[model samples]
Target: MLNSIGIPGLIIILVIILIIFGPSKLPKLGRSIGESLKNFKDSTKDVIIDEEDEKKEQKQ
Candidate 1:
């Protein structure tokens, strides 16, 4: 679904976000989003490692 948005669509979305949040808040919002994504990725990686360990244990 997101693939179809293209560059123009992204620009429009960013413009709307900027209008709503303003330039000063944009950096803060971006930082929060980045942190959220990082946490999500770390959690997923941990889950994957746990699953792999369980699979290895089952194979023994």
Candidate 2:
């Protein structure tokens, strides 16, 4: 779904966010989003490793 949104679309969306949230709050919002994504990535990596370990145990 995001793939369909090209550079122009992204720029428009960003502009909208800027208008809605204003410049002062944008930094805080961006930081929170970054942290959320980082946590999500770490959790997904752990899940993948656990699945691989389970598969290895089954094979043995």
Candidate 3:
């Protein structure tokens, strides 16, 4: 859905977001997004590792 937005459309969207969030808030917003993504990755990694260990234990 988002890919349907061409280059110009993407640029327009970015501009709008910048206008709404402003430069000062942009850094904080980006940091929050990054941290959220990192947390999600770490949690998912833990779940995957736990599942693997469980499977290994079952085989043994």
Candidate 4:
């Protein structure tokens, strides 16, 4: 989905977000988004690991 956006589209979106959020709040917003993504990634990794372990146990 995002593959179609390209750099210009991304820049436009960022500009819109900046206008809406303002420079003062941008850092906080970015930090929040980063933490959310990190948590999501960690959970995804845990799920994959659990699935792999389950598959190994089933084979054994």
Candidate 5:
């Protein structure tokens, strides 16, 4: 899917995003997205740890 967007298409998309979002809000928006992704990663990590603990308890 991503490969379908060549350099020109990518540039156009970025330009549109910049216009819609604006420069000032872009950093804040990027940070917000980064945080949400981090939260998702952390939650998945916790779930994996819980599963490991459960398996260990079962083995014991």
Candidate 6:
């Protein structure tokens, strides 16, 4: 869905968000989002490793 937005569409969306959130809030929002994404990525990696370990044990 987002892939269809293209560069111009992204620029427009960013501008709208900037207008709504203002500059001061943008940094905080970005930092929070970054942290959330990082945590999600780490959790997913842990889940994948656990699944692989289970499979290995089952094959033994």
Q: Estimate, for each residue in 1-60, the C-alpha lDDT of model 3 and write its tens digit.
A: 978889999999889999999999999999999999999999999999999999999999
Judged by lDDT against the true structure, how good is candidate 6? 0.98
TM-score of every candidate relative to the true structure: 0.95, 0.86, 0.84, 0.89, 0.81, 0.93
Task: Rate residue 57 of model 4 by lDDT.
Answer: 100
TM match of model 2 to true structure: 0.86
Between candidates 3 and 4, the TM-score winner: 4
Tens digits of per-residue lDDT, candidate 1, 1-60, equal: 999999999999999999999999999999999999999999999999999999999999
The local distance difference test score of each candidate is 0.99, 1.00, 0.97, 0.99, 0.97, 0.98
Candidate 6 Cα outliers beyond 4 Å, as residue runs: none
Off by over 4 Å in 4: none
What residue runs in model 5 are displaced by over 4 Å at the alpha carbon? Answer: 3-6
RMSD of each: 0.6, 1.2, 1.3, 1.0, 1.6, 0.8
The TM-score, computed over Cα atoms with residue i paired to residue i, of candidate 1 is 0.95
Rate residue 24 of model 5 by lDDT. Answer: 97
- TM for candidate 6 is 0.93
lDDT of 2 at 5: 100
- The reply for model 1, stretches above 4 Å from the true place, is none
Model 4 local distance difference test score: 0.99
Error of 4 at 44 (Å): 0.6
Candidate 2 lDDT by residue in tens digits, 1-60 = 999999999999999999999999999999999999999999999999999999999999
Collision pairs in model 1: none
